[model samples]
Target: MTSRRPLPPPLELPKPGFGRRTPPALFQPIMGLFGLGLGWRAAAGAFGVTPAIGDLILGATSILFLYTFAAYLAKPLRRPATFMEDLRVLPGRAGLSAASLCLMLFAVVLAPYASGLATGLTLLAFAVHVGLVVAITLAILRGPEEGRVVTPVFHLSYVGFIIGGLAANALGYPEIARWLLWSMLLPAGLIWGASARQLLTRVPPAPLRPLLAIHLAPASLFTMVAAGAGLQAPAYAFSALAAAILIALVVSARWLVTAGFSPLWGAFTFPLAAFASALVTLSQGQGAMSGIGGIALVAATLVVPWVAYRVFKLWPGGKLAAKTNAAEA
Candidate 1:
């Protein structure tokens, strides 16, 4: 009998370039800024301050949304394994949250210019957002005990729901919005409490210290969501709490920045934008606070582009992940 020849092992392709290494979560800060800028511009129009600025910011938001959406769509084709890998981990899973936020932001931006298109986009985004949130929540619940590290970024998953609720309100679905908002309250509180406990117990690694700024995001985002839903009492209360958290974060800015220029710095961008947006919402007609909100909005606008530029420069070269790993080591 002739001996059967063994088949060769399957070929393993080399990892794709920096582009493939780019996480969907990387777009979170960029989209957050675009959303904040769009909101501020709308506020400006409402106040009769600079209606032209609204159009300008809207154009910018459109450009960013298109670019980011294209990149995310291409990601699966470029690296099929990334999707499954991201699903396997807590931190990587936050990418879905970022994707949901980006979709909602797109819906918001599209609303004024194209009502039918905006409604269609909002419906699509809402469906996707709900699916992702439920999936991520289940993963966490069924995950191993060690997988439940309560880092600031983990809160992004819950933040996604909050943003979706706001988007629902914008789409004129107050009941749905209210349901979404209330549903997230317990999860958000648990995450915040766990994170706060972790912080009190142990200093986070240097690479992760930058994410401490993320602690401010939930309160800031909730304030805006509450205001959007016309819960004035809770909205104002959350606004005060958000301001306090912002001040505390600012006081520790030196310690936070001492980590310096890691990709993790992206953690700082979205939270600041959330705070500024919340302030703008609170300042609707309040004189001095209005001036303060305008200033905060301008500063956030400038800072976001700088952060985006840094992320882009490092991301394309694959330095962001490399630097983060080296620091952790």
Candidate 2:
């Protein structure tokens, strides 16, 4: 047998609510309120229930609130002491977290312009989105340090949003608007997947792979539909492929869920399955069930915000104050 070196001692995580005077629970309701507000605004927009002015104000305000809170999170994480502690807990996790923050900011500022004409905003947004894509791809290839899981999983959202933007362009949709879709929808699902995967992995006989697929399936559905529509392939063929993939994922996911995984993860999977089925129906030049498909599409759209709300309530920012010390230690 070859000689092996001993590993370094485990790193110390900062105490929960490390520098905060207010209890960590105070942040819970705030995150929930922000989630609810954003969801309400988004739902109103989708159902065409809100006035243009109301929609604009609500959208801008929700973005502003999320931006502000994200900024607040940055302040603490950026500090030398806290930053160092973060580096210790997950080794390379802090760096990737920092990168994720940057990518999130870039997606916000640059995505609008990127999907449109190469106007200044579009150019800026394109640059930012590309930057995010590059950063995330690198992070994945580099791999994470011990006990660090969620960060990589969260970063996958960036990939989904980027893929969405690409699909928007390929499919001849309101291209610029697709960028916004990528910015919002993709990240929420990916982040949830990452967090849930981390939690699930801690159980005996780690169920990491399938738990992850539960989150990945939705975006993949969106991707396959976009591909089917956008590709030069005959419509029937494209639809058939997408349908097959969707069926496979759903079958596998059912087994995984039955094996004792959280249903929350299935939230991401099933909607994608629905969306994929809709795309298959649409592809055959068949509009027989278009109305039903449209309704299912709308419901699938709601999954993200609902998942966002539940996730925030469950483990916003991946913190659980009650067991924080034990878990982190």
Candidate 3:
């Protein structure tokens, strides 16, 4: 009998060009936070508080935005089909929502300096975000629960809607903004209540534990938006609630850390940034709160860069993608 040759290893196919090697949408909040950091610092300078730092951050923000926007442009070109496929999934869909909000927030942050251009961009961003919110909401309501899991990312959909409204206010569309703002309360309330119940009742899998940080988002965002809209009592209430949630999360830091590094860790960045932004906004003229805002700003300043570094380091090598795939498996 002739000896049979061992079968050659299965041929490995090259990755498709259109889809993200990692998730493109994951970069949304990172870029947004960078914009916010610079925007806040610039605002401080415009107010005569830290001209040098503001100038430095503004320069950095411009450079960073060019880099990120270039990368954003490349995603669809690389894998148009894969990009579309991602949007069909829950987390991927949420990422799209976050992307629109990122644009909205970035525009809002820059509106003071670039009033005309920023206002136009903000309106465009708001329209896109609201459209996505409605589409995603309807899809979720109508679609069967096949692969859907109630993770914190789902909150991004409604969060984008709320942020859009806030951005509209910043762009001087007060009536439209007020309507969007009031519309948010019922949906936001329902989402927060449901998410809280889910988290308390069931422990999220290891891959998703990092999403616990998202619990801080709604409260923090509401605080900022309420303060911006002159709703002082609601702003204070949300601020207190945000602080409580933040404290609880900090207390459980060990558990979250044990989940290890995944792209999901990016979830931690924007919420903290939002909380810091809220504090800064609320502290505008209050002496005692200004110190707290300063401290929060410093923390956000450090945290965002570190997280961005970690994400980039992992992303280029496919390390985060591998971990995420394994966790999902």
Candidate 4:
């Protein structure tokens, strides 16, 4: 019998350029800090703290990354040959690009409405948002196709961004804001629900499966915000939307135990959940005092440290098997 030849092992590739390679730990902290900044901003705004520092920090960090990411997209102008050809390469990441656009657009509209430092920051934030959105969308449209499974998760990121903006606005224009909130929430809720179901049923591989699993936290947080916002928007529209967001958060929090957190991934949830809490709470108020979201403000503030501790435990390079197919795929 002829001897069989062995196939080559899979190639391990770096993301592309020196700029893409920030030390994972450092990046995690930076991302987490931004998340914390966002959460604090939500709490302060909900409680009627003027000169909203949390809002400023959140806007600043957001604008910085938005601009930086946007700059990355422009590289193709120099190296036309390096352009991405497949959108599926990173899957859910593309969804995030789409979500960022939603944020940038909202910021664009919000800038004109907000006062003080927020005005200038909001304008810059909008520009950055626009740039990042365009770049990521183009990247996904051009990137490879295999990793597209994660695409839904990326879209979910928009849910978090929008929720933050909504909380900041705090029923700014009850009818218009409510419409915008529901517009994004309905599709997001359906898509996330369906996606989570599929992932669970299929029993996807590690890394990704777990990554997708933790996504529920952020998803739940977004739903909470949506429901809270809806209830505030108009009592008539409250029942359905409120139920959806509330149910999702409750069910997902339970799932969080088995799935656990990933510092890298879990970082997304803290601020999001906090913002949701603040919004929902703030919505509970009536008339002038509506700014004070009460108990929700307190609970949401606690979530930051709680999520932070859990996140540190699950961060990459700890006991968990960091090298699952998802990170590579």
Number of the top candidate by TM-score? 1
Model 1 bad stretches (over 4 Å): 1-19, 87-91, 134-145, 321-329
lDDT of 3: 0.66
Candidate 4: regions farther than 4 A off = 1-35, 45-87, 91-151, 157-175, 210-267, 270-276, 279-329
lDDT of 4 at 273: 39
Clashing pairs in 3: 17-78, 17-79, 18-78, 18-79, 19-79
Using all chains and alpha carbons, the TM-scores for the candidates as numbered come to: 0.83, 0.45, 0.82, 0.51
What are the per-residue Cα lDDT tens digits for candidate 3 across 1-329?
A: 99999999999753554324545545644544654564366348333476566556545655655465565456666645544455566556755666777677667657667879887887787788777767676666566785455556666776556776566667776666666667777766777788789777877677668777877877777777777777789889888998898889889888887868666677788777777767777767367666666676678778776776776676554565454431110
lDDT of 1 by residue, 98-171 (tens): 76777777777776677788888877887887777677767777778877677676677665667766666777
| Local accuracy by lDDT, each model | 0.69, 0.39, 0.66, 0.43
List per-candidate RMSD values in Å: 6.5, 11.7, 3.9, 8.4
- Which has the better TM-score: candidate 1, or candidate 4? 1
Highest lDDT model number: 1
Candidate 2, residues 1-329, lDDT tens digits: the string is 99999999999755465332111222222322322232233334334444453345335534644554454345445453432233333212322332333333233323343534323333453554566456545554554554334542343335434433433443355444344444555565557556657555764232333433434333433444344344434334434544454466457655545544322242352334334333533433236434434454455445534544443454444443231220222
Candidate 3 to truth, TM: 0.82
Greater-TM-score candidate between 3 and 4: 3
Superposition error at 320 for model 1 (Å):
3.9
With a 3 Å backbone cut-off (N, CA, C), the pairs that clash in candidate 1 are: none
Count of clashes in candidate 2: 2
